[model samples]
Target: MGMIDQLLVIWGEPAAGNRQVIGHLARSAGEFRFWYEDDLAKAQARGFQMLPEFPVHRRADDPYIGRYLFALFAERIPAPTRRDSAEMMTAWGVDHPDDQFKVLARSGGIRATDRLELAEYRAVDDDLSRPLEFRIAGRRHITDAAPLAVEDAVSLRREPDNTADPAAVIVDRMGRKAGYVPRQYTQLLGGLVERGVPLQGKVVRELLLPDDVGKLVVRIVSSRL
Candidate 1:
């Protein structure tokens, strides 16, 4: 089975004249490539997502592409201090916001749209599979399919009696328990879910079973990779 490979980002402009960094994925994965479908004229408090690992560049390309790559992924770490270098790397998350981004990519053609907007958490919890009283609250491996293929939507179930964990439990759209949010992630991811930030999940690969689908590795991708 393939591991999850996608990331979400809160779409925000670094500052004036530094907008080029928007939608500019520094690196690429296998066959997929990501580029901003349009330009951002202003800061969008809204969150955005992309496959950071998708392969979009070639062996040879514009010098500018190579120049800005470091800024995009490293979040401007080791920022060049030179007066000239700093001016050039302005759009490369030069300010260096604490937020992180992850790359969730698929092997074949990318099914995600350019926007990659994360759906609201519990968006599908009340759908057809949902029961009136919500019986399967703490269940696991209950769905035959992944939450979302291209862009994913996962429901966060807080596990209280979760002898294993208490931070958070990842459930599929159908409310099947998928996995736990790593302890490190619970602070951010768990808080997001609690605050209603749509935690999107991407199913890069899965294990198929005769009677049912099994072991769906849905990677929760986000700006905080």
Candidate 2:
């Protein structure tokens, strides 16, 4: 399996609403950069603050508070990092206060009924300027054929009639079908294909157990021109 870089987007409060593209998380020459959509001075003037230890209002006077939250920890979140259960729990916080958190905010404008603040970013050279990579979130992987060797690169095909995911993914081998793409990525990658976008995937990992369903890890990288 190939060792690839993966991205995990942690969303802040008010999950839904108009999320302004304040900026993006990207990279250049392997250096991390948190580019700002708006000027730093302007953002500071907007009353951006991240006191997550205290109860920050989900409905605060300042609309950009959510973005400020991401700004609080922009330097810590890098691509291709693995987090354990303890870390995730710390980041998500339980019933009480939790300090470990990193999420980009989305603010709904004045007229919007619901709004949330947001912030976040990354770095890279001009050739790879856009943040085009995303990891699909799914619970299980399905297969009816024998396990493929670990790290076998495969093609991803569309499955229009898949009951579980209409935009299902069918993993392929040398031009024939091998297995289905992980459940979570179905609709997302499928939609990209429908729009005439091509895709490329690599087997990042695989683990076959004699006592249970095996696990295969496939990573889809953006091939958009």
- Where is the poorest 10-residue window by lDDT in model 2? 103-112
Q: Please, what are the lDDT tens digits per residue for candidate 1 over residues 6-105?
A: 2222242223211112343333443222344343333334333333553332222331243223333443232356555444333221233222221211
In the order shown, what is each candidate's alpha-carbon RMSD?
18.5, 13.1
Expressed as tens digits, the lDDT of each residue in 107-180 for candidate 2 is 10011222222222223221212322222222233334534665676666787886755766677767756676
lDDT of 2 at 81: 57
Q: List candidate 1 stretches off by more than 4 Å.
A: 1-153, 206-225
| TM-score, every prediction | 0.28, 0.37
* Model 1: residue 11 alpha-carbon error in angstroms: 33
Going through the candidates in the order shown, the clash numbers are 21, 21
Q: What is the lDDT of residue 128 in candidate 1?
A: 17
Index of the highest-TM-score prediction: 2
In candidate 1, what residue range of length 10 has the lowest lDDT sum?
Answer: 128-137
Cα error, residue 3 of model 1, in Å, equals 19
